[model samples]
Target: MKTTNYDIIIIGGGMVGASLACALADSTLKIAVIEGREPPAEWPADSFDIRVSAITRASENLFRHLGAWEEMQRLRVQPYQAMEVWDATGPGHIHFEAAELGEPNLGHIIENRVITRALRQRLREHHNIDYRCPAHPKGLLPLIDRAQLQLDDGSRLQAPLMVGADGAHSWLRQQAGIAVAERHYGQTAVVTTVQTEKHHQDTAWQRFLPSGPLAFLPLPGGRSSIVWSTTAEQAEHLLALDAGEFMAELGEAFAHRLGAITALGPRGAFPLKGRHAKQYVKPQLALVGDAAHTIHPLAGQGVNLGLADVEALAAVVLDAHRARRPIGALKTLRRYERARRGDNLLMLDAMGAFKSLFSNDTPGLRELRNLGLDLADHAGPVKNLIVARAMGLDALPAASLATS
Candidate 1:
């Protein structure tokens, strides 16, 4: 059996793990990324991913700090200048503009593959980091001073700290005995990209329907991506639709705002749920990204939240290392948990409230919620506050999310 050693081991070399590797690249510590799948290669110029994210300014800063943003810019990203949100039942609507906030753009709509490829490219350039593909941790053996990892390929490695960035079903988190609070939303999101007859003008649109929220995020080249969340049966039926019929249904749902919608790509559905680890750390192990928590996609904040987690955890670990403290010390890990828990719980709760509020068929409740939106739209101070919060600008954010 092969034996290796490292100062730290990060499981799941996805976006967050790769970003962490780049952040720690300059450190003297030895790092290893244990990945179950091969890292993504550079995307072809014309390729598009169905999955996309709204990247906030803070998330962009973290990617820049890790040297991945430059690569992403070289690839493809669409900057959205405005956002329009409306409720289906009433004339309640709200609009946010980047210009109003004295910024060039609110956020960017970026393809998931582009970001993943860029991060992987950055990771490849770091000599201090070891990229182990098609690797899985067989088990974790805790020691007084360090922890031992037994890999599926009959390899042994030891590290003072192990990070689980392994998505919602994190093996490391489970192995470390971390409990998670989970709730099923009884909904599913159908995602796809569509070509529109008219240009989107770099604006994103969202509508709250009786079933769920449907969002059309503008993409470059006169195209847009859709995230339509609905009840399980509806989602299944939509997914089962043929390309032409599906686009017809989508056009009706979106009210054909971008003119005639045509040419639907492959459609995929993901069950909607909220999950948060009861604790973020245990002894020598720490969880980040989806491993730590997952919120509803209604606000388009899922990846942004995970990126925030990455940024905060990275700063805490780096600061501890600079101070010559144990990187895996429980006291140090507590700082990370403290910084993220409240914000994560808030997002989860807010999404839950929105889901329940919109899903109700009661006329009175619908009127009240729509009226609330109308009121917020006319209230300058309240509108500014909400927009700032959505852009990740107003709150006293974690160090990683702080803009310069």
Candidate 2:
């Protein structure tokens, strides 16, 4: 088998992996990005993708830094100015505005395909990056001085550092024998695009129900993207419903906040699970994105968390390279681990707590949460801080690529 060498071997070329490559564009390091599947050349402009993400301002900063944000905007993106969260069980509600945060807008609602496409396009501009699509890693080996990946075609790639950005079921993580702790939320996230009777008003709305949270994220037009988290049985029921019935139920659950759902697009559902690796780094290896941790989508922090990993890992790796230190050394990888592991765990735990707190129907618990929401709404400073964190401002600063 022929062998190829790279300064870094990224085992997945999804958004996170691809963004990492772009983040290191100015570096002289030779990199290889192995991706199993390739995204479509272009998406239909008239229809929207069912899979979408709420991109925080910090994430937007990273994309802008990478030179992909403009293209994404050209393709399609919705800038949501406000977020409204309420407890359906009580009269407790909280709202956050971009003006309060001293920002242009809170975040963006962009299709997953749009992000991937834009990142992929950016990947092509970096001369140091070798992107291999329709390629799968058959195996991975962590060596004393290098980590190696064996593709199904019998080609091998070696690098001082290897990254597992493949996803929750990370093949690289599994091959390297990293253990993961997983908790099934026993809920499924049903996602789709819909046209609302009332415009979404460029606002993000989430209503907590006994079953789970239903979020309506604004889109470019009067359309909105919805994520409905609910029990498995109920999810199946929702999926099985015809368009009319589903729209009726959806409108009712959302309290017609956006008025009726006049039109429906394709629907998708995936099981929700919280997974965190026992360790984020090992000799000659590191993990990022869903490979490192996954949280419930109720908060839409999944991709933001992944982008933060990209920022931190890129910074540490660039720093190491400049210092002429071993980028893959355990000591060096640990820096990235230390910077991200604690934060990821904190988010996972918080999501779990929110899931438990909102999914309960106890009258007293409902009242307490409603009161908590009320208090939080009135607590301006505290609320702004929380929203800022969500915007990726307060917690982790954007990654710096300048040689330190």
Q: Root-mean-square deviation of each candidate, in angstroms?
A: 1.9, 1.2
lDDT of each: 0.86, 0.90
Where is model 2 more than 4 Å wrong at Cα?
402-404
Candidate 1 per-residue lDDT, tens place, 161-218, comes to 9999999999998898889999888899999988888888899999888999999999
TM-score of 1: 0.96
Superposed Cα deviation of residue 24, candidate 1 (Å): 2.1
In model 1, state the lDDT of residue 171.
Answer: 94
What would the per-residue lDDT of candidate 2 be over residues 346-379, giving only the tens digit for each residue? Answer: 9999999999999999999999999999999999
Clashing pairs in 2: none
For all candidates, the clash counts are: 0, 0
Using lDDT as the measure, the top candidate is 2
